[model samples]
Target: MIEYFKSDARLLSPLYEFEPGCWVNLVRPTSEEITHVLATTGVEEDFLRAALDPEESSRVELEEDQTLLIVDIPTLEESNVEQDESKIFGTLPMGIIVLPNTVITVCLQDTTVLRGIAQNKVRDIHTAMRTRFVLQILLRVAGLFLRNLRMIERDFTKIERRLYDSLKNEELIQLLGLSKSLVYFSASLKGNEVTMEKMLRGRILKLYEDDRDLLEDALIEIRQAIEMAGIYSSILAGTMDAYASVVSNNLNIIMKVLTVITIIMTIPNIIFGFYGMNITGNDLPFAYWWWVPVVISIGGCIGAWIYMKRKDLL
Candidate 1:
């Protein structure tokens, strides 16, 4: 899908014609739409292809007069129906192409960052101020990371509580999934930080005082996200370790109880085995004396029990 927008009184209003100082947002563009954009906008096909490739890395490139910037953005997808967890999240690449009097954003899927801009939730959005607009998008991406990270943290905490009473793989599976997400976010945030730092130091965008400040703010947010990912990853790791220890300790307790019971049981078996043996079948000591073994077995069991109790093995 493709939509065009122009700044209208601090809001993004849909545009019906190809206008200068407009924003073109594309989501999963078709081949024909791709060809048309290529022909009309004169943007090289390489940039569009990279944007369409979901596996593309985050980087900045220059082709002719346009600057192609790709950044990875986080997204959530529902887990399989059989999975107890509701959703899992990861990053996908988003492309931003800076052209004269226009800026184009292309991504494989719709994101909150774009929707917020469409809804006029952002304070100021002037298409003519392309550099600042890009900064704002970066800022929104950073905030989105923080928002999603908090959600992951909360969900993991809930799962942690569920895992307290019982050991189940479903909850741990979800934790593993979330941990994988944090790894992606960490890498992407680092990539975006480098890109932003380069922009700050390089002449890619002519930065005004306000633009510089906005860029710095976005940079700070990105750094915060990086830190958040690291902290969450560590927390998840610790949780896994704690659960492992709990399980190991429980197993030890179970084995010890079973061992004590077996030893107590063996005492009776020893008495029965010894009493059944006889040198002469008919001349056995007290021929009709089956009760003798029973009394002996009972006495032996009691003795074993007393010994174990004293030793605290029970």
Candidate 2:
């Protein structure tokens, strides 16, 4: 779908008439719409197609009188229903095409930050300059990463509490999920860092001096997010290890109890087996069968007590 927004707070028609200082946000644009954008902006068809490709890497290509800046934006993974644990979400591909007169953004999925910007919910902006708008988007992306990291931290803490109380497979699975999410976040931040470095050094975006400061701020936020993700990843890894050890220790205790029970039960079984095996002329002459049973019962009790005491199973 294609949605066009102008700085004057007017929503354009679906035909997407070219205008200055307007943002064209496309989510899963149709082929005809793509052709329209290309034809209106006079951008190369290949450049437009490349921007739409999800697998396209982050790069900057300077076409005559235009610049194509493709950046990878981080996005949260959707929760999976089949698995007990959540799955890690990967980065979404986003395209920022800067024409001399307008800036166009294309992505496959709708992002919260973009939505907020589109709705005029973000403050301190009467008009959207191409450079400032891009910087705002970057800043929002970084902020989202930090926010996601915080959420993951909160989840880890809850999981850790449950883990300390009792070690379960589900807890481990959740820890794994959190860890994977951190991994994804870290990777996306690194990609963002690289893209930012290129933008700063190459100066292809013709970013203003003030906007450079904003980019630096965005960079700082990205770094902070990366650090937070690293810390959480470390904590989750340690927690997982500790949980595994606890589980192993619990299993050992259970096995010891069962082993001791087996040993104690074996005494009576062995004694009965010996007595049941009748040899010729082995019977007692007194015919006091009660005494035999009493003697065997005493022996079994003594044996069980000694075994219990030795194994600390009492």
Candidate 3:
């Protein structure tokens, strides 16, 4: 999808056609739309297509009059099923191309970072301030990372609570998913930090006083996010290991109980086999000779149960 907007009175209003100082927002643009954007914006084809590649790294590229800033943005993927706990977090490279006449953003999917700007949810967004606009986007990207990190932390807490009396794999699986997300967030945040630092150096993109402050704010958030991701990842790793040990210990307890039960049960069988042996003359004082073995077997079984219980092996 392709849409054009220009800020009017601190709000992004729709535009019928490309205009100077307008924002071109593209989400999974088709080939024809790409061609039209390239023809109209005169941005290099490589710059337009750089973000379309999922594996693209965060970096800044300058060619003559145009600057391409690729940054990793946070994204959430939720499961389709109602009961599926498959909320996975990831990062995608978003392209921000700043030109003298226009500013363009390209990404494979519409993200909250851009959506907030487009919907006027963000404050002080002006398309005409091309450099500041890019900074705002970066700032929002960092904020989104922090927001998602908090969500992950909340989820870890919830799962940890559930894990106390639960022995299900589903919760552990979800923890693993969250752990994987932390890994992704950590790597992406670090990459974005490097890219932002380069921008901060004033070599790739020019920065005004206000824009420099904004970028610094973004860097601070990104750095905080990196630290948060690392902490969460460590906590999650330890939690998983502790739960794994608990599971193994539970299994051992079950096996020990089963072994004790089996040993106790064999007493009756052995007694019956010995009493039923083919003996021509079996002398017993009781009128019912079979009662002797039955009583003995019951006594032996009780004795074994008491022994195991005292040993704390039951």
Determine the backbone clash count of candidate 2.
1
lDDT of 1 at 289: 84
Model 2 ranges with Cα > 4 A deviation: 9-16, 81-88, 126-128, 164-166, 280-287, 298-302, 310-314
RMSD (CA, Å), candidate 3 to true, equals 1.7
Clashes of 1: 0
Cα lDDT, all candidates: 0.86, 0.74, 0.90
lDDT of 2 by residue, 180-256 (tens): 77877787688778888778774678777888998999999988988888888887888788888888888898998
Listed per candidate, the RMSD to the true structure in angstroms reads 2.0, 3.1, 1.7
**Candidates sorted by lDDT, descending order?**
3, 1, 2
Give me the displacement of residue 224 in model 3, in angstroms: 0.5
Location of the lowest summed lDDT over 10 successive residues in candidate 1: 78-87
Model 3 per-residue lDDT at 296: 90
Candidate 3 has a TM-score of 0.95
Model 1 misplaced stretches (Cα beyond 4 Å): 80-83, 278-287
Per model, how many backbone clashes are there? Answer: 0, 1, 0
